[model samples]
Target: MSWTCHLDETDVQEYVGRVLGTGYTVADVTKMHGGAQKVVYKIHCRNGFACVLYVWDLTKNYFQEEIANERVHERSFGGHSFETNNRWLRNHGISTPALYDLHTGQDRYPFDYALVECIEGQKAEAYFKDPDQRVRDEVLERIGSMIERMHANHRQGYGKPDQSGNPRERCHLVQLENAKEQLSYIVLHNGSIRKNHDRLLAVLHELESRIDSRKRYGFIHGELGPDHVLVTDRLEPYLIDIEGAQFFDIEHEHTFLELRFGKHYRYFQQNGLDPNRMLFYRLHHYISLTSGGLKLLHRGFPDQVFASNLADYHARNTLRFMEEWQLDN
Candidate 1:
């Protein structure tokens, strides 16, 4: 059974004092929601200072399984990944939260933690609900451009930010194998997935044959969604939750954009993308999400409703996409 590790008053007080120096007393620590892999707290200081604290602990991670070798492209749940990715983005002229201090040792806390600059803004997801169309359009344009900039930064190799040199295998084949593993996991855990397992596998195999080999790769946010973007009062957008940022097939990033951005994805859409890669990546994304959601549910993630809904939504989409693909073919 999994459980969330929350820091007590003393824990927060000492950490804050050490990081922020003297005269910074903790007024309150609000546990932020929507994070499944790590514990995040918005720390408000008695002296009107505010910052965010991130704790990476096994107890906080909802997924219980060991990290698979094929999943090295996307890494998270550690201070090292966060710190490295933060510096990489900043060096590349991308906007990310400034790191105030980072503690990787186990002396202070059993888990790694970091103090970061708290971005004072609403998530780009919130802007979608605005009554003004122009407001929505402008935000979309800025975010779309920011992503384009990130994608334009090319790399010879594909992997996590800290990984150097080329990968041993092609990106698509690696993810295809990972997709099969995810589908198998989903089938075992979800009754709904079990019922349609064969059909899903058939669709995946059909898509696999259409994929073509590619050499060049681009830097991508790995999981760029409006929710991962924070828009300041001045309308500037900053990418957050950036540990997964890496160089990879741009198609993988676009596949996620289409899923997360939904109708607004058109603003960020670009030409010259390979159609075959897009279709293959789309199926893989659905299977991956379904498996991840089920893993969270089985391991007793804190938000039961979110976990259940995530699994159901993606599992249904997997079946729906299969049926749609079959009909089109």
Candidate 2:
């Protein structure tokens, strides 16, 4: 439940005044792009301090259920969770945003805001088509190395690192149910309904049989796409938007990155990792992505234009998966 919050300089100055103190004044508060469910702004203070501000939109929640802290309809944990995850990543040698301050709700404003140290860089996707092949290859290798470092950390269970003690059964089961509901909706309405439905179910069953519940899991960004990877002028890659960090099968993480970059799959793969397992997870990921598109279409939560675009994306994934399935068989 989130809504747009249009904040002027006065609004930001007042908010920062309350959080910081009287001496500090906001010089500029510029809204950044690519916040699907939240409003992001780069706040610069007259005192030479700069930070990234995240204002949680209370009209729509990103997680299926409210995360860590929920006060009525307001989401309190959006910032805290990311702050926690960022600390974990930093401790494990991952370059991420550094948290400065987090406010749930104040008398002046009634929403969440987290201020973190801003990393100066353009999105890594900006370099995906560089004319210089050397530059492109170097960036890809660096990205691959960063992912490998993150995957190196092992955990005993499969769940979010921040919520380690809690029973993951609840979260895990909820995901399975959501996936089924979305897949079911597409099967009922789309032209490629029957084949998609059957294939998705078969892939799920295969996943269940192939996965070893006893295997150790590792931390994964869970949402590492080209847009999320930022490259500084120095060629360093910083992963951002890590609010819901979780530990899961490392291979699942690998498959997703492979899907995005396409060329770095072999670079990250270790010896003895079962190819069958990787293929199954890749299939499952595509199915889930397609299902996600269908779910968006049904909800119309993000509006009709966005929903229509997503449904089209699902159509594209459907065709690609069909071709891959044939090669595998």
Candidate 3:
């Protein structure tokens, strides 16, 4: 679970030279700021051209069983799927970084890497931080429109995309089971939640029934939020870290957007989403995040204090989701 920089300056320069012709030299490679799990390096080219390079983080803190499955499926061993998803979205008129080159690490680089056109813009989180309400609202509107368009590209099943741009049906059960497992982990670790285990399990069972019986599925950014959106000076929003995206209930996505932004934001006003299922998925997402942090805590990866704070924050949010569900009832 300890991820360190595997590629050095020389490796990057050589890779850039190979990708961009002999004259294009890498002047600098600086780590870019983002919440993504991959190591992102902004490579400055001599001719004023810049590109972003991402190396897969192999040392992810996953459960032992999860790691075994990942190895069997060869997940994160290369950037082919990442390129595929990016190209699929770009073909559908979504604004995303153009892929320049992808190396699976079997050829040259020591790790799987992707070189893509660098986008010049501030992350949407910065806009949210702005004191001006007008700026925030404007950005919110743009984000909402983008989300709608992304949802327009749908598939038959629920999960990650396959070669045919359809959801990988094999991942559907795994995704649901994983959610249930995370909820169980949360209940087992927290004393307060343990007392209400029966109630929580009943709610989860109901939510699972609702989700499993649904046939509607749409392409969605699984982790859509301000942090994942980059807004240019012209206010154009570009999405990043789309590897986790999949075909799922669009209403689930809507709930995520509302939670990240505000439920009263103009975006939610534009559409009517099933509030009950939305809140159910909201708790699922919240618990998954909190559980991931707890796993990190168990592995001694992130600083214990930071991990504790993160788990606390998400736990509070999860409780709020439960309260909202009760109120609706």
Candidate with more favorable, higher lDDT: 1 or 2:
1
Off-target runs (Cα >4 Å) in candidate 1 are: 1-11, 66-73
lDDT of 1 by residue, 127-239 (tens): 88889999999999999988898899876778776788365546777777878889889888788778988888888888988877666788888888888999998888999
> Model 1 TM-score?
0.91
**RMSD to native for every prediction?**
3.2, 4.8, 4.0
What does the lDDT come to for candidate 3?
Answer: 0.70
Cα distance off (Å), candidate 2, residue 59: 0.9
Model 3: how far is 298 from its true place, Å? 3.6
Off by over 4 Å in 2: 1-11, 17-23, 46-49, 60-77, 105-110, 165-178, 194-196, 264-267, 295-310, 319-329
TM-score (all chains, Cα) for each model: 0.91, 0.80, 0.84
Give the clashing pairs for model 3. none
On a 0 to 1 TM-score scale, where does candidate 3 land against the true structure?
Answer: 0.84
Ranking by lDDT: 1, 3, 2
